[model samples]
Target: MDQVVSEKVARDPTADYIAAIEEHGYVRIPQVFDKSTVDTMLDRVSAWFDKTVQAQSARMPRLNKQQPMVYNLQSKDIAFCRLILQTPVIEDILKHFLNDQWFSSVPAEDPNYILRSFLARSSNYQMPMHIDSFIPYTGSYPFIMQCSIPLEDQTRENGCTVIVPGSHKSNKYAEQSAIEQAIPIESKAGDLIIWDSRIWHAALDNVSGRTRWSIIATFCRWWIKQAFDIPGNMPQKIYDQLSNKEKAVLGFCSVPYDDETRGIDMKRSYDLLPEKVADYRI
Candidate 1:
């Protein structure tokens, strides 16, 4: 299982993850899932990756060979859609850090933070140290946060992630000099690693010659434009399988309408979300 090597591990149910993120920029929760579930997810994600890479090979030849990341996963399979629901802790953490002034026709307990992006990839190359918060801003609070879940063991040998602690508050990108401060975060399958989007992080090269796949789902303030147009392209097969909360996170309730004929409000509540996939597209 993934263990926090330097940081004092959170072993109690009431562990202060919010505080951890506030002070250290990230927190790692070891073995949040069981072996069986990890095995199943690894199987599904691997199969999907293989099929998708093959189809997109000609169009994205360089990325296929270099990165091989899959995009718009919510529309591809029920398994990907369900990943968010399986982690209540992630939602709770997001609510505290990201949800505020989430306007609209407000609903009683729907998520205030919507998913900005969701994708899975196997790292084969070294990613330069950088921050996910593209634009620099002054603040300890982050507008975006990322949840990364590994489907298998991650070590320095297989391109484990590395991070510079407490870097989010800098409100700046990593300088080449910061590389000396980066520390490896070795983890096992099913560990949940959440970090402020501004944190400096990168992946090592996979010298092990084996696939090291992980799911990275980015959550942000409701107002931020999701990296993918999920609601516009969410397949009927996937939409039909989602709950009201899931649909909202997938942006079904927040998509802008083409005309006033549909509606003017961009942010909406659970009650406003259409139950049918046919009415999902605005």
Candidate 2:
């Protein structure tokens, strides 16, 4: 167990974040990136929102019924998203969460798919309670993390994330409680909230009239189905242009014929093409 964890840290120096996740099931790393980057994303978000309003004539409906006050944006716009995907802090955190082998690309633009980007308005907008993991299927070693990056100051009155501490070990999901213990995550724009999926959490009321915008990127083991639609919704041009490595992460590669028989005898070569036989006169 020690060696397994040591190997993970070697891949990236930011292993304490992972240790925190293992021990506490969550970690709020402060100042993972400079304030400028966070501010830039906020600016980009504001500009995009303005453009959206003009294009739709202020008629764009709420993305999800539960999130009327929030708008999901920046799933596309590669120029603005490259920073999120390539941020060293994000990579360090992923190194721990994915156990060193996971790789995922940004989803292309599609109306059917969306990543969670919430802009909370009024201290009264409350998010319904939920756990991120699927109870029935998430067996012993369920590795998943919900990463929240605040774009502005998050206060208790600003709809800060509310999480139930040490709930990851629970086998059954708990019901909403009037007496539920909720930990409010307060941070500046550049801070990160990486929480275990098993922990029950919700977006609580933002009493402040100002909007509290947040960008959330949730990641899990490669085997788990992605939260957002991938190839089905990804642009064809984008899919066709990817390399073998990208395709494998995108779930385009074939699995071995059997579970145990896989890789040992068959040795699924992700880089190798199918064996082709040419027609010949015998």
Candidate 3:
């Protein structure tokens, strides 16, 4: 069997990643998490999916049974929130691409990268080639990016993601001809694959008998509408537990002013810093 070799310890790949994405529209960082951490996450996700499926069946008489997938994972678990907000390498890469002034500026700009969507998928499923930015209501500029973290090895048999290199620069979706050239990005457990939202990508069929688990998270500029109302849907306790920076990234700072009511309540809702307030004013 072909195996993807990975580092035993985590290291920063920001410089290499920036270059790779600029040139190829995607890059993979190996062993961002240890095997134990990946195993724990996989177990938690499996348990959650089982519970969710049971609850869904109880609520409805007819059930459409299918491979388990849990969306809005950040709201579902604090562990997911920690993974998204506190992962150092992920943060570095996102800041580099989304906030250009990060290196030169002291107390770098927030970038206001909101977690637009997050989900965990397991089982035999294949996604057709598509550009996420082309979805309705998605806006351009300071582009949206997606990060995939696999809890199990991604292989040809387990539906690893296939992507076209340099497709983001094309400024157009892949035609049938271009998609024929897409290549699968085989990776090991704990590997992270980050790609531009404009890149043409798809998932291969999973012929592997066991479930193939992976988490997909998308982040975008604050101005873009999120796939979910993250803050509002979150439990009040979870919302209160997040740090100010985490809250800002999750879009607590992106609230628009009440032009109709001219209300200050929106401002009062969050403890926004001077810089954030200034950015909001613009």
Question: lDDT by residue for model 1 over 1-282, one digit each (tens)?
Answer: 222523245455425777778788888877877788888878888878787875654555443366857776777778877876557788778877887654645664557678888888888988878888887666755789999889879899998988888888887877766777888888889888999988888888889999888888998877789987777777777777788877777777678777888888887777777756667644
On the 0 to 100 scale, the lDDT of residue 161 in model 3 is: 80
Residue 87 miss distance in model 2 (angstroms): 2.4
Q: What is the C-alpha RMSD of each candidate to the true structure, in Å?
A: 2.9, 9.5, 6.0
Listed in order, each prediction's TM-score against the native is 0.90, 0.65, 0.80
- Stretches > 4 Å off in candidate 3: 1-12, 54-67, 100-111, 135-142, 257-282
Q: How many pairs in model 3 have backbone atoms within 3 A of each other, for residues 3 or more apart or on separate chains, i.e. clashes?
A: 0
Arrange candidates by lDDT, descending.
1, 3, 2
- Compared with the true structure, model 1 gives a TM-score of 0.90
Candidate 3, residue 184: CA error in Å? 0.9
| lDDT (Cα, tens digit) per residue for candidate 3, span 1-282 | 111223343254477676777778888887888898889889988888877765544332121136567777887788888877889878877887665342231135444567888888874777777788764232233468898899999888988888888777776765656657888898888888888888888777788888888988998766678877775677666666677767767766665554645434333224442233234422
Which has the better lDDT: candidate 2, or candidate 3? 3
User: Global CA lDDT of candidate 2, please?
Assistant: 0.53
The per-residue C-alpha lDDT of model 2 at residue 263 equals 38
| Top lDDT prediction, candidate number | 1
Candidate 1: where are CA atoms >4 Å away? 1-15, 57-65
